[model samples]
Target: MFFIYRLFLIILLLFTAVTTVFSQGTTKEEKRTLKKARKFLANEKYQLAQANYLKLLTLNSKDVVYNFEGGLSYYFADFEQAKSVPLFESALENSKEDTIPELCYYLARAYHINGDFEKSKEAFTHFKPFIKTSTKSGQELMKQSDYYININDNGKKQLANKNENTIIKNLGTSINSTYGEYAPVMKKNEQVLLFTSRRENGTSKKVDTDLLPYEDIYVAKQVNDNWQLITDKVELEKYIPKDLNTKKHDAGVIYSSDGNTLYTYKNDLIWKSILENGKWSNLVELDKNINSSQYNIPSVNLSKDGNTIYFTTTRKDGFGGKDIYKSSKNEEGKWNVAENLGDKINTKFDEDAPFISDDGKTIYFSSKGHDGIGGYDIYKSELTDNGWGKAENMGIPINSALDDIYLIVDEKEKNGFFASNRDGGIGGIDIYSLCINCPTKIINTINGLLVDNIETPIDGTLTTQLLSSNNPAETTQSKAGKFSFVTATTGKHQITVEAQ
Candidate 1:
């Protein structure tokens, strides 16, 4: 009875994304199981995906689609690629029955990564023949990937050996799920983390792009060093409203240094949320000149000083798919119209997800236009006296054959996080932290609630003065009536709160 009831509920959710389009000869149970599995796969939740697929395989071990998708789920999860190799081989054997070119490709890539050179060569030989031929002799695929097979094979080797000094680890189930998580921004002293997800937290009832739920912001509080493990069927603790989230895509890019302002994505327009008296406000559309409403404004980052914003947009008049732009606050503390970062940073292909360093001189972002190993690779550039300098790929181990984006780092460049769907992760687009052996910043997390006499959150500015260091920090006001300060310097500190 319980299983039946659960299936009934899932079927309703499945209807939001999946149609009843089972191939003839499949039973009702098979259809349900397959849809559930596919939904999990689409959401990039590998554990559930692999589990559901294994259930379906019980009915038929050699089901080509099942094997292919199962292999994909495992391969993408990265945590289970060794076990998935056989699944890929199985998919390859039945590839003719199901049209899975990627089966051969992934199998070849897996063997290559595992150092099975002979087997990898054989697989790669088979994989390359499937590449679509070009009408003009040399022009095929992207010019950068003219030797896609060879370059990918070499790039895999580079990824295998590089970055041995950098320790990268998964954030576990608390902040990440089988669903996608990206664009991580942590609060003061890393006490809390905010990012975007397509998990069940979304209010939208429909499935996007066959498997994606509407993107929504998810917050996870860190208990010690780990995120709280999410229990099944329980409501997620952190979220925004339907107005800010909507049925369309939304994501968070950065939180102000003071920890009171959240810069986020709503309907592809960048919006900032103020936190005051423990409440978050509705996202007001930012400057019309920057948002443009006619174009998409996806990713954004704020300066350490909070006076400038670096963002990405796809305007009709843009160089291409997307371009990085910047807007500086005027003397009156309002944003001026955004200006493109220029040809040095923008390119013919897509460039987005800009992360400006604390000094505002170093910039990190992902771009396909810049020469890369494959797909989207994280790149870095410096703001020089002349202009934004030419971008360079972060290279091999840090990048992969697939999309790698939203790379962010801490003040010391010693530790931070980024989102990637790279093979061998626990799920689709998981968040991974990178530690580069830099000295850890010893810091304190200072928090307080600012409310008027009525105890309601009111517009205010909170400043902390470090007497020893002769330094000062300011915070933004949100409806939540709260303020926070993260400081590394040790000194007697005095606090002040003023309301307009």
Candidate 2:
């Protein structure tokens, strides 16, 4: 919490707040460069800041403050371990707070990001005894690190997808690259696939320090069960001239179930774009009721009915970093104030990339706070009258030792998709297809919008039903008046809606 508050305000406060504490000898020129770099970080200009940090390191490679801040810029911006690891290592070597709580925690985390699980484990375990009694949040991070290291050791055994009974397939070259491509969402007809990518798309003019550009929204269509990338036209990929891309992070997109209104994420902000006459409209930020650009709204998902929006936000009032929150769109077209999903769904660490399946009974999300294998493992929680049931880690093939997030299950429930940076061919984060059970079930799908008798938009106020002995095999709630459900192959499925 303080990191977000302090990091963003580094420019105005660093000289007074941190520079004096660590008096690393520096020349006047280096000090000036340090000030400039911190200012770049303040404005979210990461690339320039990284370059300045490189210059500062030339002056003082072991300067803890400079190394830490430089590593932070790389960590937060492009996520390049190559750049962040050494800097963080230097910071740790020069840090006096190794025995202290937060300082060592970051160093351990940096090691985790670098895929050095053994080193990460050593760092965390070295300070484990001290960390547990320090602070609640520090204790939480320490506990999570143990699980991360264990996953690293045991992750290779997961073969749920390799057996003849189950299958796992990467979305392949068209949809992936040496860069990251993640957060897959499909329209009702399965005609379009919208995913986020950070590859060189010949669109964005700006690239962060690691030479990778910002995340951009991209669209691909299915052709014979494969995604076809139309290299000629990138729907909303333009980054120059400050149009849709805004020269910043814009990814994590989902649709209105009808596949018209587009929802996007840019770190802390949530924006919507509508398809007007087959062209996307300008991005419009969600009302302040749901967004406070000051807080982070990293990932978002909507129920099939489009009545409610589930998002992970670092709102100040939350239990920790990024908590899942939801808001309903009333009949009057006004969004109700957002509400946190409570302690069960959130933790002392970050929780993000919430995906509520077709029937609304299942919710798949990613969390660093949960007792998952590592980093951010995708977990599933079911909603009952009592509230969300205890979240169960998806386990094995669905998760890995590295980060896995942004899980979305289709209405059919037989096949699903999730994003993972697991050790695989495609670089960064790639989307993977998961066949639910060993022998797949026949998935007769039904999805559409929900509305009141007057045809006015309805959200959480209305509930839909799919009648059968195995009723509502997969259910998704309504977000802003859209809903979806899937049933069986041989059985008849009837759609019923009632006001709550």
Candidate 3:
């Protein structure tokens, strides 16, 4: 009986040894396959690499490296929607070490790319702590993931409350093409649409076509609701300085309320130009108070009085990677030093693309820090006498799980334009306009009957115009001394009643 027991133990030991050797051989084979797959990925042969990684997964299903590589390959091959979840899930669930955090981050990113926002949020929450110690890209991905989850929970409604059942029609051939057209900005009147385009024009020199250098800013004017190309008026090509004409990147711009001062981002700095005598003068760097040596200031918003400037900067001492900073003109006309808006407005993520309403009470901006529907969603916060209020998501149909930036609202028209790289776009990014549901209320009005040195109602001889302290150009006339106007915005205005 003792001899039989010893023989059984010896057989069991032999079986265990054989299993160990076999597992080591499989791990070696997987490492080799992963090496080959990584080589293919580096060479841009994503399809081939993906196939090998998928095969390796069958051999060693618990290999975190293999799963992560496979997820990357899937992402690069645009198979993210199909393969990302499994690769990420396998990596997260079966990882041997405490690599679950990194795995969760990747899984969240994959879910985000796959449009599974809720799942992405769950993964992100699991990954947040690890993000602080990970690579820069990992941190950025985590921030983006968190943003999408937040948008899904809080801002989903605002993003979806657009014209219901209206299939988002393409802006048509005039506004769209096989190329890219995006980041549309318009004047207060909504007649002029200034957008960025990568169309084939005379400036289509292939100096550096990898990043699409044939890009140019284009303008289209709406004449009777028909858009007509009007790039000639602005002479966009002429404004491109020799240094800024790099075929790599030269496009984002925002015109001031008066359409004279223009702020644009190019080559990691905000450049300012004035439309003097209908010609663009030399481009100059913005005030140092509004700029930083660390991060680029890509977007800017000016208050109606042009005294307060809000811009995005990646400066150190910021809340996160990027934060919004405000610089205002003091009583002496020099800009006060830049001040952070603090925790209420900024997050430990990127906050950018600010747009203050004409009334100065509502502020619209894009943030990766705030809870958003996706990549970047527009958020609005009201300015109380105390400080900025908690931001509210602009909501869906307006917001998507894609990058949405550069929002401009025409408070008078109850319509606005925003930039998106969402579905139904020409390619890359495109500008979209949708009518907003803006309810107007009547504010108390003070009226005066102008007469020619007599207490009588003047007919056709009295001229009445409304003027505001903030906007000098926003003037509307009322004839015959009987002026009626709706106060859609809240501000101080003077009604001048005079005899002409």
Candidate 4:
């Protein structure tokens, strides 16, 4: 009897060892894929990282770490931000206490971004006790979370009171792409439109500090009272001012009030070019007083006379991440040292993309602070006789739960242009035409089969990337030699195949 019991125990141990080996073999591919995903996440390539995580989820959907990381990837991505909610919830349920300390915090943010205020507040409450305010980062997190909580009431009120009278229409795929499009400025006559875009075909085919495509200024003209983009790359080059768009980061800030000079952002500084004889002169950097920061100065606006420049920068000694400052030309025509816009217009969070009204008494800007619903929201403040008035949110349909910025209105405020990354758009951060009181009316998927030289479909794990001259590459993997790629803009595509 003792020998039989010992034999049974030995067989049970041997079977357990065999099962462990099989499990490791099955998960080897997943482990390798997870490493790639982590690398992409570290690089801030959220979309690419989520793709890898999704592949891993297919191998083990119940993985807590995979779901947690996947949630973060979608949360930081350009569009489809609401997809993070389920992923976060799945991970939160299975994680041990404090094992994933910020899980609830991020889940709360996902809920807020998705406009689910009740769940957001609940998740935020659950995460609040874990914050250690002794540390600077923790203090900042606490402040941010408190701000979100306070704004929930106002955000809900604003959503309920959406202004249906206003009509905001997207500029369409011709002017927008999968890459971010923003900082839109139109000529006073509305005959010409200029904006900044990040695309594969941008100045040098190189990425910016964010690892995304570098920004480039693009120009479009109104043909027969209808806006038309220059589809031909050569024609686009002809339309854009010579040497205005460079190999480095460049974007349209604002045109000079008289429209003869163009103010632009280049390499974290402000630059200007004069339009002479239908040509733009070489770029000249702004005075050190205005371009004071070694860090980014992402946006600027000018008073109607163009004497005063209002800009946002991340220079130290500011109110927060990016503060608003103004520099005016002195009597000798040199810009005076910049002065902060003050607490009335700035906050502990980022504030940017200021648009000074023609009257110069009002400024419309985007803010991640204030009582924003979730991400950056458009707000306006009037310069009262006392001082700058309290910032008023523009309300829903114009200010979404996502980023909405770069609002430039005409003299009458009848029509204008802004940019947003809100859902229901054709691409990331599409430019939209704004009509205050008027009416409004609002990707290519590629399928491929991997084949041998003899045109026979090969069955194996294969990676494929769709390359476009005008857009970034889209990647996908297939196990049965079948793959598909969905691109942002309409353009010719080339397939690059790699065997695994």
lDDT of each: 0.67, 0.67, 0.62, 0.74
Off by over 4 Å in 2: 1-166, 209-211, 234-243, 440-500
Tens digits of per-residue lDDT for model 3, 331-424: 8877799888777678886787788888788888887666666667778888887899998876666776666777777856357777766543
lDDT of 2 by residue, 211-289 (tens): 5677776777776655786444443332111255556777777788777787877656888887766577777888988
- How far out, in Å, is residue 22 in model 2? 29
Q: How many pairs of residues collide in each model? A: 17, 23, 10, 0
Task: Report the alpha-carbon TM-score of model 2 versus the true structure.
Answer: 0.59
Q: Which candidate number has the best lDDT?
A: 4
Best by TM-score: 4
User: Could you give candidate 4's per-residue lDDT for residues 63-122 as a string of tens digits?
Assistant: 778888888887777766677888999887766554455777788888887877777788
Which pairs clash in the backbone of model 3?
A: 151-371, 151-372, 151-373, 158-395, 158-396, 159-395, 159-396, 159-397, 160-396, 182-430
In the range 145-244, model 1's lDDT, one tens digit per residue, is 2344554555656565666555565565556776778888776675666788887757687877645687876667666454663232233323333245
Error of 1 at 307 (Å): 2.3
Estimated TM-score per prediction? 0.64, 0.59, 0.60, 0.74
Q: Tell me, what's the RMSD of every candidate?
A: 15.8, 17.3, 20.7, 12.8
TM match of model 1 to true structure = 0.64
